[model samples]
Target: MRVLHGLEEIFAAKGSLLGTSDWVTVDQARIDAFAGATGDHQWIHVDPERAAAGPFGATIAHGYLTLSLLPMFMVAVYRVEGARMAVNYGLNKVRFVTPVRVGSRLRGSTELVDAQPLDGATAQLVFRTTVEIEGAERPACVAETVSRQYFGD
Candidate 1:
C-alpha cells in the first residue's frame, strides 16, 4: 500500500500511480445482496441458470455494484496519516468497460490525478481508478473519483 504522511504528500504525488489493491472476488452471494439492496434484480446479474444461455456465459455483476467497491478498493491503495477524516465528494466520470462475471477476482489500480488544497485543514483529491477483472484484457470499470480529506488540527 502507498502511505502518504500528510495531505501535502498526496498533493505532491499527483500524476503518479498510487497503489494497486488486493483482489476481491465478485461472487453470487455478494451480487445477490447488492441486488437486494439496490433493487436491481436483472437476470444477468442474479439468475445464474438463465444467464448461462444469455450473455457473458454466466451471471455477471451490475456495473454499479462494481462501482460501489471503490471505497473498499481505495482503502487498500493508500492512506494519509494526518488526514483523520475523509468523505467521498463525487465521481467525475465512470464507465463499465466490461462485465464482471460471477466468481471473478477484481482489484483496483489507482493513480493520483489531482490534489487541490481546500482550506487550512482540508484538501480535495482526485483519483483515476480502474477496476480490473482477473485475466481480462479490459477493466470491469474505470472511474474518476473526488474526495475531501480533513486533517487534524
Candidate 2:
C-alpha cells in the first residue's frame, strides 16, 4: 500500500499503479445479499439454476455491485494521512466489460489519474480503477472514480 503524505504529493505524480487489493470472492451468499439489499434479483445474478441455462452459464455479480466494491478495494491499496475525512465525490465513467461469476475472485488495480484542488483544504482526486476477475481476459469493471479529501485547517 502507498502511504500518501498529502494531497499535493498525490497530485504531483503523473500516474501510479497504487497497488492491488486482496482477492474477494464473489459468492452466492454475497450475490444474494446484494440482490436483497438492492432489490436487483435478476436471474443472471441471483438464480443460479436458471442462469446455468442462460447467458454466461452461471450467476454473475451485478455491475453495480462490482462498482460498489471500489471503496473496499481501494482502501486495501492505499491510505491518505493528515486528512480529516475522505468522501466519494462521484464517478466520471464506468464500464463493466465482463461478468463476474459467483465464486470468482476479484481484485482492483488503481492508478492516480489526476487531482485538483477545491475550495477549503479539500482536493478532488480522479482514479482509474480496474476490477480484474481471476482467469478472465476482460476486467469485471473499469471506472474513473472521483473523491474529495479534506485535510486539517
Candidate 3:
C-alpha cells in the first residue's frame, strides 16, 4: 500500500497509479447478502439455479455491488496519513463494462486523477478506479470516485 504523507504528497501524486488491491472473490453468499441488504434480488444476481439458464450461465454480482467495493479496494490501495478524516464525496462516471460472476476473483486498480485543495485544510481528490475480474479481458467496472480529506491530523 502507498501512504501519502500529507496533502502535498497527495496532490503531487496526481495522474499516477496509487496502488492495486488484493483479489476478492465474488461468491453466492456475498451476492445473496447484498441482495438482502439492498432488496435487489434479481435472478441474475441472487438465484444461481435460475441464472444458470440465463445470460452468463451463472449468478453474477450486481453492478452497484461491484461499485460498492471501491472503499474496500481503496483500503488496500493507499492512504493519506496526515488526513484527519476522509469522506466519499461522490462518483462522477461509472460503467459496468463486464459482469462479475460468482466465484470470480476481483481487484481494483486506483489512480490519482486530480486533487484540489479546499478550505478548512481539506483536499478533494479524484480517483479513476477500475475493478478487474480475474482472467477477464474487460474490467467489471470503471468509475470516477471523489473523496474529501481533511489534512493535518
Candidate 4:
C-alpha cells in the first residue's frame, strides 16, 4: 500500500499512479452471497451447472459484483493520513470489459486522474480504476470513481 503523509500529499498526487490491490477470488460462495444481497440470482451468476453448458462455460460473477469490490480492494491501494474522512462521491463511467468467471482472481490498478480542492481542507479526487482478472489480457471492469476527502483541521 502507498501511504501518503497528508491530504496535501494526496492533492499533489494528481494524475499519478496510486497503487494496485491484492488479488481477490470470485468464488461461488461470494457470488451466491452477492446474489442474496442484491437479489440478482441470475442463472449466469449463481447457477454453475447450468452455466457450464451455457456461454463462458462456467458461472460468471455479476458485473455489479465486480464493481462492488472496489471499496474493499481500495483498502490495500492507498491512504492519506490526517484526512478526517473520505466518501464516495460518484462514478463517472463504468464498463464491464470482460466477464469474471467463478474462481477467478481479480485485482485493482488505480491511478489518480484528477484532483481539485473543494474547500481549504477538502478535495475532490478522481481515480481511474481498472479491475484486472488474473491471467487475462483484458480487464474485467474499468471505472472512473470520484471521491471527497476531508482533511483534518
Candidate 5:
C-alpha cells in the first residue's frame, strides 16, 4: 500500500496501481440482502429459479451493488493519512461490463487516476476501479470514483 503524507505529495506522484482486495464471494443471500436494503428486488437479481431460466442462466447481482463495494475494496488497498475527514464526492464514470453470478469470487484493483487541489487543505482524488470476477474474461464493474480528503488544521 502506498502512503501519502499530504495532498501535494499525492499530486506529485504518478499514478500507481494500489493493490487488489481479497476476493469476496457474491452469494444469493448477499444479493437478496442488497435487494432488500435498496428496494431493488428485480427478478434477475432476486429470483434464483426464474433467473436460471432467464438470460444469464442464474441470478446476478445488481450493478449498483457491485459499484457500492468500492469503499470496501479501497480499505484493502491503501490508507490515507493526515486527513481529518474523507468524503465520497461522486463517480465520474461507471460501467457494468459483465454480470456477477451467485457464488462468484470478486475483487477490485485501484489506480490513482488523478489527484488535484480542490481548495485549502482539501484535494480531490479520482480512482479508476476495476471489479474483476474470477475466471471471467470481462470485469464485473468499472468505475471512476471521486473522493475529497481534507487535512487536519
Candidate 6:
C-alpha cells in the first residue's frame, strides 16, 4: 500500500504508479447481488445457464459492476492522510475494454496521473486505473477518476 503523508506528498507522487490491489473474484453470487441491487437482470450477467450457450461460455459481469469496484481498488492501492475529508468528484474517460466473465479474478492497478491545488484547503486529484483480469491479455476496464481532498487549516 502507498501512503501519502500530506497533500504535498500526494502532489509529489503524481505521474507514478500508486499500487495494485489484491485480486477479487467475480462470482455468480456477487453478480446476482449486483443484478438485484441495480435491477439489471440481463441474461449475460445473471443467467448462467442461458449465458453458457449465448456467448463467452459463461455469464459475464455488467460493465458498470466492474466499474463500481473502483473505491475498493483505491482503498487497497493507497491513502492520503491528514485530509479532513475526501469525496469522489466524478469519472472522466472510462472504457470497458474487455468483458469480465464470472469466476474471473480481477484487480486494479492505479497511477497518480495528476494532482492540483484547488485552494488553500482543497486539492483535486486524478488517477488513471486499469482493472486487469487474471491471466488475460487485455484489461477489463480503464478509467480516469477524479477526487477532491479537503484539508484543515
Worst window of 10 by summed lDDT in candidate 1: 3-12
Q: What does candidate 6's lDDT look like per residue over 1-153, in tens digits?
A: 999988889899999999999999999999999999999999999888899999698999999999999899989989899998899999999999999999999999999999999998899999999999999999999999999999996
Q: How many clashing residue pairs appear in each of the predictions shown? A: 0, 0, 0, 0, 0, 0
* 38-76 per-residue lDDT for model 3 (tens digits): 999888998788999998999999999999999999899
Worst 10 residues of 3 by lDDT: 144-153
How far off is residue 152 in model 5, in Å? 2.4
Error of 1 at 28 (Å): 0.5
Residue pair clashes in candidate 1: none
Which lDDT tens digits does candidate 2 get at residues 1-109?
8889887777775388888999999999999999999999989998889999998899999999999899899999999889999988888999999989889999999
What candidate 4 gets wrong by more than 4 Å, as runs, is none
- For model 2, the run of ten residues with the poorest summed lDDT: 7-16
Best candidate, lDDT: 6
Residue 88 alpha-carbon offset, candidate 5, angstroms: 0.7
The TM-score-based order of candidates, best leading, equals: 6, 3, 4, 1, 2, 5
| Cα deviation of 8, candidate 5, in Å | 3.3
Candidate number of the best TM-score: 6
TM-score of 6: 0.98
- The global Cα lDDT (0 to 1) of model 1 is 0.93
Q: How far off is residue 2 in model 4, in Å?
A: 0.9
Q: Name every residue pair that clashes in candidate 6.
A: none
Error of 6 at 101 (Å): 0.5
- Pitting candidate 3 against candidate 6, the one with the higher TM-score is 6
